[model samples]
Target: MKMKKKNKGGLLFLMSVVLGGFLGGFVGMFKAGAESNGIILDVKILIPWISAICLLIGFISILLTFNFLKKSRKFHSLYQEEMDDDLNEIYYVQMYRNLEFGTIAFNITTVAILLALFISVSEVVILNRSNLTLSLSFLGLVLIFNVQKYFYKTIAIVRQFDLAFFSTPKDVLEYINSYDEGERQANLEQSFRILFQLNQYVLPVLYIFLFIISFLTGEIQLLAFLLVGAIHIYINVMQLPMVKRYFK
Candidate 1:
């Protein structure tokens, strides 16, 4: 227990330091960018704005990471508890960790994209005053579609896990200690209903839309799309028990 306490203290310290650095860099980046650009760096004033935007993104990244880390630590603690014969607690605990991991990935990606967008915007604004000439007619569209495909898949996994964990009563959600059978049945029913809806319609629809958008935008987006797919697959695999139980 002492060791565990020390570990959490270390993690919190790290989170604080990281958050402070990100926030500092964030403000400094924009201040420098804006000062460097003066007033009208371009007709759109894109030069200064992009850096500021990235700064804002970095700020968001810090927040999400902080939240993710905190939540994961909590889950880790829960994981130490003894399990019942049903072993449902483990499933919920695992689900929470997986969700936290997914959130971490998403935040990391956001940070990357935030940087990329700033860099790309800067290039477009200053070094090269040029129109984006990449044709969206063929492969570009394909790449975009693929990215969308994976994005939807990722969303589906996250949603499925969320609903399953929240709705399933047997193992992870065993806390609905209703003395009355009617109340317990209602709780289970509500959970099942929620999962059923999310697993069937919400996830599929989201995937279709994501895939379609990528298709329309072009193949340039494929790499981004694949990352989304990878994360989705990860969460799906990670939330194995809850997903399967509700799904079946």
Candidate 2:
């Protein structure tokens, strides 16, 4: 029995999960202590800093994802030449797809953060959980499990393809194209389109409404939500120009 080498993207995800879990746990402990002391968490005192941190993390992750996508695009462009040799196209393809999946997972995590911020600002406790840290830790664990499951499933599917049999560039191209075609392509396109539209239009309008309400009511908590929305809008705008290339 031999252990398989972990994919680099998978390793990065593992690191992120571990880091996120620890951070969440630490924050949870502080939150628990604050609650125990009968200290009401001041949104004005805390949310701005927390939101700033979240925005920084989100931006870094988005930048890394963008770089990975650019690299994958480059690889695809040169894949024909690379396939002419004995290079393992399967490995490259798996790596590319893994990065893509990682980006999607990160985006999902960012959205979750935004949702949490929204709920906190609006004082809507859907889960009746008073500890923000515990909630964050739970979210981290859930994301970790789901991301690992997806990566494993993707690897299994990639393993099913006999890349060694593809001796010609045409064969490699066909195989890659086939994988990107049909239902997968349609779903990917649809998802991207929806995301683009939501981020491009719906989110900005929603944020404007929230911002105006917050300003009128003098709610400091909404600052975090507004910041998160602004960062998300910037990210979406940056990625819009590349969407066609990404989905193509």
Cα RMSDs of all predictions?
18.7, 18.6
- Across 1-248, the per-residue lDDT of candidate 2 in tens digits comes to 12335576578679867975776576667667877888775444554456445544544554554455455545555554465554557546745674565557556555645644554443325434354543554454455445444443443343334433214776645445656456368667987887887776667656655654454334754666767677776766777667977888
Candidate 1: where are CA atoms >4 Å away? 1-43, 84-248
Q: What is the overall TM-score of model 1 with all chains considered together?
A: 0.28
Per TM-score, the best of the predicted structures is 2
What overall lDDT, based on C-alpha atoms, would model 2 receive against the true structure?
0.55
Model 1: per-residue Cα lDDT at residue 91: 48
The backbone clash count of each candidate, in order, is: 12, 0
**Where is model 1 poorest over a 10-residue stretch in terms of lDDT?**
131-140
lDDT of 1: 0.51
Error of 1 at 71 (Å): 1.2
lDDT of each: 0.51, 0.55
lDDT of 1 by residue, 103-195 (tens): 554556455445645555555666675423212122223433343344334434433322232234463344345224775787679767866
